[model samples]
Target: MIFRQIKLPPMLGYLLIGMAIGPHALGVIPSSEEASHLAEFGVVFLMFTLGLEFNLAKLSAMRHIVLGLGLAQVLSMLALVGSAALLLGLSWQVGLALGAAMAMSSTAMVSKLLTDRNELQTPHGQNAFGILLFQDLAVVPFLIMIPVLGQPAEQLTSSLGFAALKIIVVLTLLLWLGQKLMRPWFNLVARQHSSELFMLNILLITLGIAWLTELAGLSLALGAFLAGMLIAETEYRYQVEDDIRPFRDLLLGLFFVIVGMNLNFAILLDQWPLICVLVLILGPIKVMIITALARLFGNSAGAAWRTGFALGQGGEFAFVLLALAAGEQIIPPAINQSTVAAIIVSMLITPFLIQHSDKLVLRLASSEWMNLATNLHQIAVRSMANTGHVILCGYGRSGQSLGRILHSEHINFFALDLDPEKVREAGAAGESVVYGDAAKREVLIAAGLMRARALIVTYAETHSAMKILEMVHQIRPELPVIVRTQDDSDIDLLKNAGAAEVVAEIMEGSLMLASHTMMLLGVPLNKVVRRIREVREARYQLIRGFYRGTHEESDESDRQQPRLHSVQLTQNAHAIGYQIGELGLNELHIEVRSIRRKNQPSIQPDEQFQLQNGDVIVLLGVPENLAAAEMLLLQGNR
Candidate 1:
């Protein structure tokens, strides 16, 4: 919870907590086979989830990165690290196991960090994920191969051949036969309409397959993965994944904890120098290999560096492989301790390294600086003519909706989005959107922030919204900025940060639900409207005086609740040639908040501003008084 509160992955906290309480430290929890066995299910479920999410369409799209770049990265790392292990005086078997383990980078950590940084759509981010996908697939073979390598020297080749044949036979049967039966079986389960039964059936299938593989002298995780792949072919895949997620996450966390519990600080301390050496070598060597491979694969130097930096750390799967090697006595105790320690250290430092990656890239590659400038230049070019336009911080669904509405209203808008695909598709449709990070001051400036009439943050991510808000506050303090939030939790925080209005979706959704319920229940429409108005008036300052109260209310003050009405001036309108001050609207308890002119930007008119024909004046007052104000403006003294 603390880690999540601080926006860090809970897996890190799990590891640290496990290390503290395990036998090597305070010994609050004794190390035991039972706990380890229970924790291994986490790995099983993780593999299952991976298989469930796997799809041919996605794989085919990323074939080059996955096959070409990913294959190169794994092979290069294995060869490099294996050679290094030999130099350290380890046996060939141990070296091979170590190579496979070190070749893996943390999928959980890198992917989570990339998403949080909103870089998942960047070129480097895509490359990193593609490579990580291959690494995940590679774990299956390593799981099978490690035990074979641990066999006696004379038996190793035969054992490997036998394992390969077993894997092929088992996989073929499960995938082929299971696909035929899976859909019908799922259909039967769905017809029952019992969630409990459905959940039980899913559990049965996953564990039953896992048990089969274990009985066949293969890893239990291998069977679970196979089970997932079979189910993925059926329409029930998403339902199965949803039902299995809690179990997967819980087990995965426990698995990480068990990994932490296995750490022998005494052994780690004894091998401190070697541990340090491995940690120092592991990250830099992996980074260099991945960077070189990425560049060779036709990526920019900037993208290559980012991908390398992102995947340089050891992964959660590395721990799994290391444990397997240790169990088979393939790696000595001292080497296992040092390698695990080094990997943990690498994982711990990965977030910081990734966070500073762009800066590091700019420093290391001159081309990166040029790339950033070019991006900003493109954004500037898009927004150069858009004075008094609305700057949209995100171009997702919410931003897209706002962009369409703005466009329909003849309001110019420039949107910045990180998702390259979204930008491309939306731009092809002639949207006034571009690919940029609105959180950066330069991007905001290039989006015409200084000339913008209003800015709206459509995404509900508070971290990104806050950054944009901070930059906007610094650059354009007077600009009216509206922020969207998921709930009321951050409403005050955003409002205090200079937002003109903070729209909480939850609050708005609840209000809408309440209004619909009231109307459906036969409550008077006027009463429902007044109830919604009261709620809005209390929550939003800008909305406080915009809605008129019900006239049937007993209290005079209730009837006098303010309302908003917009009146378009005709050529013969009495107020067409008059300055706002000369209209004497104040005497009628009316206020002109803004005036929208055709083919021109809306403005908050001052006293000296003269009204023009076809101007839509937004007026605020009681309904009765607003009627008089409209008559006075449209005709003359009425």
Candidate 2:
């Protein structure tokens, strides 16, 4: 909360929390051992997720920035910074450690800050992210080398060569495993119809791969990265990202807090002059190197400087290198303590630098550069337009699938996605995809919403979907809107918000299962189709009164019932393996109108019927009872 007035990054605030409660300060978390141990998993999960996001196709597209500029930035900063440290009276090993630490920049901080500023799609922002991508991948080798650097001088040559070979071998093996093993395994997990199993599989792949790399004498981060890359090649990349993000972020915060606990306030004060000197030395050197690399690689002067400002901070990896160096005795404890303070302080100032980048760069480049950027944005807007085209929000798997179908039928549609990498790849492949948030009315208009044939929202996340729906209603009320949802729980909410068609994934999957079963049982295809349509027609009104806002009346012609809910039972749900008659639904004040299991629908399922996991129970009750019933069903008599 104090960060609100300070205007510092939340990460820095997290660090402060750690520092204040740490052994060195309040002694609230006196030992710090357990916290640090748990926090180690944070680095593991983070690297795993990073690997998942490292789409080979996307990186290959930004090859110049990723390989050329990113490589240059790291190498140059390391070389120059290392040389400077050597001249400053440090041993070669310590100098190398110092240089490696200085070469790093925070991916999480820079990307997130740029996104908040809505500059992620801008040239400079993309350049910054691309450079960060390389830095992230480079950390594996850095991790490998750090330990080797700590070894005796006689062993350095052989260890270095072995490390290089392992990196190549590990990467090649990951590629092979991704193609031959990971894909099939994930497919099996997905087919199990168990969300828990699916999530478990995700965890296994992540931590298991991370462990494999650690066993191979490489960093756990490297293994996790490879695992993520393997998953990225599959259709489940985004879902995997969503499933693991909360765990990753939580553990990552723990990791950062541990890092903060290492910062002794007394030491920081005692070495204030030295800390300030190091920060002053590191920030500009890193920035100048990055800016020079960006400009040399064809970025405009303003863009180059903006890129510099975005990445000026010493990254989280700097802390990793510093800690390892200290532990290995490659760098003196005093040096690590002071250098860590400098790195933390550098990170502390990055957000301010990024927020004020344009203002800072304007002083460096004339106003004409800004004008040119504006013209480019205008050109981009013009290119996104095509009258009568459908406006497709989100270009993830669902959106891309929809676009392909639309294209097959010769329907013009432009894709809008927030992921810049996806946007760049789509654009390169001659797909009509725009990089922007579709939840914004301006972004919608830019995609030619007014002249569009219809709107299809394939984005995940209910809140953003609702916002897009509301905006669409406000802009052109008559435009047919179809939205995809993860489940039936939000159907009524979306329907009430003016969605013409709300596809509930769980219910639809159940319907498909039922339909296929009927056909195999000698039922005619026409009969199967009619039955499936009838099921949708039955609960077509979706959930109503579940949310207060959903109680609003719709002016649309169709007046469907609003209080029905289709809730699915997860594997570990409390009510799983219990019968409807046993649960005493009447006492709970809820009614199970129907139940869907395997490939069959039971209308007003018999009280004697047993409940299994993954049963889609259609409940009808008042909002309060429905909520209680859902809780009861999932929790099993709790």
Candidate 3:
């Protein structure tokens, strides 16, 4: 129960457990060569999952920012860091390698933090994810360059061209094959109904593609990620994901722990002063540069700052690249050790840094340049709030279509979506939108719910929707509340909590489906449409009448009519061998609507309907009569 109450993440607990058992502490798992191999698998799985979320269409839509801004940031950072390294007496090849390592940001850490904070679907989050996507893709080129650049007599020009050509060919082939072949194979596996076999195939496909990419002289991570993206395009993607998650999580935890183990605390302590200076200077400088680049590409100032804070820490891939360099004698082992130590410290502090980033930005605003960016952000927010608007929570298919209709009608409304890319796209299309969890009071306040005309929730998660409704009631009970659900069970709860309307999506869908089937069966289209319209209108009127306390007459009518009650048998019930129709239920003022046998579907009861163990019977009668019937039915047991 205490575990249920704590707002802290489960990941934090995992990280703490890892730290406690790490080599620097209890040393339960010693940092060894075998441990390193396990850690590498963690990275592989992490990249694979990341690939699953990559959308080629969406990426194409944001090509200018993702490709252009991403290229600018990566190239500039590489140049700046590499030039500095060269001046510090490092060879040019080593300098370039170090620069490439530093230029990349940690996708795993930043994406997780954003998601945990429910900021992953925000405009800033989209921009950050786009940039990270590019960085992940860039690993391929960087991997190829390392071997050529780290050579003793570096013929850089020839190697660079060859590497570029090779990457283009491999990426093109992967994309083509992934689109043409992978989706069909996944569908075939799904049809088999053997979940274990499907999952096995998923793992094999991911790792096999990754191995192929590595054999082709590209990064294994790039291949794994690409394979994931291919699999994501299929309808069975979520099923595959559900199966692979346990493996992905366990391996990724090992990766982080191994990262911690690689830190040389003694060397870190010896160079603490230098390391502190570098972290303080480089971290903010890199973030500022990237953030500025984001702003230049048309992101809001707040979004830019968010992207900066998210990507401020060094990425895990940097360690991989640095290790490669050290192995090839391109960089001194001490340099690699120091860089890894710095990265670990930076990552550890990042969560705190982000949590308090707003205050830090205000302090930094004293600078003239920073103040300019801050002012621009204020303008952006003002521009977004040209008029008071309704706030719509949840942008799934129904919500999205409703939003589109709202847009066509020229309504001023803001949307809050859980999916980062959707929110980003909405913002890009000039809609007033924010990414956030609607259940949180702070998130609601941030979205300006109190000032909005209405709150519409279009998702089917009952608890969160109810929570939002309660919060809205507490703040402004008069505000109109509209919600959509998939079941009738929550109707009373939502109504009591003050929702003005609760449209059942499943019921509506089923009704529509029935109408279409009727039309296909040769019913006149006009008659079919009229019947559907009448049914829908009647439902609306019924609900409205019920809420207005005018449904007492209807309730009396229902009481006058016979009612139904159900009794499901438990394993220990004494009536297992009894036959329902043979028990003379008619004499007891009861009727069976249906009976279900073990491992079989429910069917209408016949005279021969046997009530074996675990059978559930549906009976109909008036309340008092039903109670008497039940008592008589259980008389023999008592």
- Name the candidate that leads on lDDT: 1
TM-score of 1: 0.83
Clashing residue pairs in candidate 3, if any?
A: 121-420
Residue-level lDDT tens digits of model 2 in 511-588: 989988999999987778666766766766333333322235564512333355557676798778888888877886
TM-score, candidate number 2: 0.60
Best by TM-score: 1
> 72-106 in candidate 3: lDDT tens per residue?
88887788877877788877887788778888887
Model 3 weakest 10-residue run by lDDT: 542-551
lDDT of 3 at 442: 58
Number of colliding residue pairs in model 1: 1
Give me the displacement of residue 90 in model 1, in angstroms. Answer: 1.7
User: Which 10 consecutive residues of model 2 have the lowest summed lDDT?
Assistant: 541-550
